[model samples]
Target: MRTVARVIAELLVTFGLVLALLVAHLKWGTDDYTRRAQRGLSDELDKVWSAQSVVAVKPGRAHAVTPPAPAPAKGRPFAVLRVPRFGASWHFTAVEGVTDADLAKGPGHYPGTAQPGQVGNAVFSGHRTTYLAPFNRMGELVPGDEILVDTATLTHVYRVTGHRIVLPTDLSVLAPVPGRPGERARRASLTLTTCHPKYSAAYRLVVFAELSASRPRTT
Candidate 1:
């Protein structure tokens, strides 16, 4: 009986070690595949130059900024964002947060931030290296990407200006225009966000882009 008890104890210990390893792998091992998928999407966006992605803007019933409205046909509402020189483009759904669950379906839109083509700052969030990392190559994006926000009603275009890495505590990057608040709303901007420090969240990656043009939907 004592020998059987000892064997059971050893088996339990082995199971515990295996469980721990599985958890760690889930947290980090999938990054390589995720990065490849992300880079592939960026490459495809670089090739496409003239696709009509439409973005429609309306008062959000929810208090969150840029809350996603349903697509006209009940499918996912996708918007095309173009950055020409950077060779970056992706279809993002305006859901909130960048969690694993949120990213599995699409890029999560930062809540309480302005929607694209709105009077304030529109912030979008995505994972950098896992869970279908749409923004993994975010650091590669350069100035002059034609950021196109498309909805069911219209398409809005913006140009990348610059980027900054700020502490998570420093959320001023989400503020309208990053410093000016009293000026009359004249333009729209896109702020893309992700975890900074490459593989960690020691800081926040922020990409700032400004509106350049707009096209109304004909349909």
Candidate 2:
């Protein structure tokens, strides 16, 4: 009986160690992987923006409405999202899909939604507590906060309208008008979503913003 008890105790310790390692990896190891991925994505954006892939706005078209470009292939990155309120260094490459693999690269654009600067809801989803947690500080955003999205040609600036906490099953937030199904979107809008309360996917925290301006890219 003594030998059996010792074996059981050893097994429990081993399990505990494994669990601790997993927690650490989820919190820190994933962050390391995400940082490396971000660097690569940033480099890709730099190349595209500096290359012939971009369309240069004319001298008199500074405020001209730039139409939305066609969606890129899934998992391919197409833009960069930045929140000034999050800090000067806060930015994430926005990709084409929100699947596990795509989000592992960065914040993802929901397929079938409006693209940046378009007159509809442009939804982006990101991990709240892992993979560098780009939206980790999303809760700190106020109604007047600015969300900037940079494509190869223009920077779309969105002003936060409001935010809400909803259940995981809340599909209304994904509507073309956001929280208003079947309603026509009259203004260009942006919605950001992430797992709520940190480390829990029970609910989603959604932030709503509307496009306030678009600036032609200079550099």
Q: Pick the candidate with the highest lDDT.
A: 2
- What's the lDDT for residue 215 in model 1? 85
- Determine which window of 10 residues in candidate 2 has minimal summed lDDT: 62-71
Q: RMSD (Cα, Å) of candidate 2? A: 3.5
User: lDDT at 203 for candidate 2?
Assistant: 94
lDDT of 1 at 42: 42
Q: Candidate 2: where are CA atoms >4 Å away?
A: 52-68
Q: Write the per-residue lDDT of candidate 2 for residues 87-193, one digit (tens) a residue.
A: 87898888899999999988999999999999999999999999999989999999989999998788999999999999989988888899999999899999999
Superpose all Cα atoms of candidate 1 onto the true structure and report the RMSD in Å to 1 decimal. 10.3
Off by over 4 Å in 1: 1-90, 96-100, 179-185, 217-219
lDDT of 1: 0.64
lDDT of each: 0.64, 0.89
lDDT of 1 at 97: 50
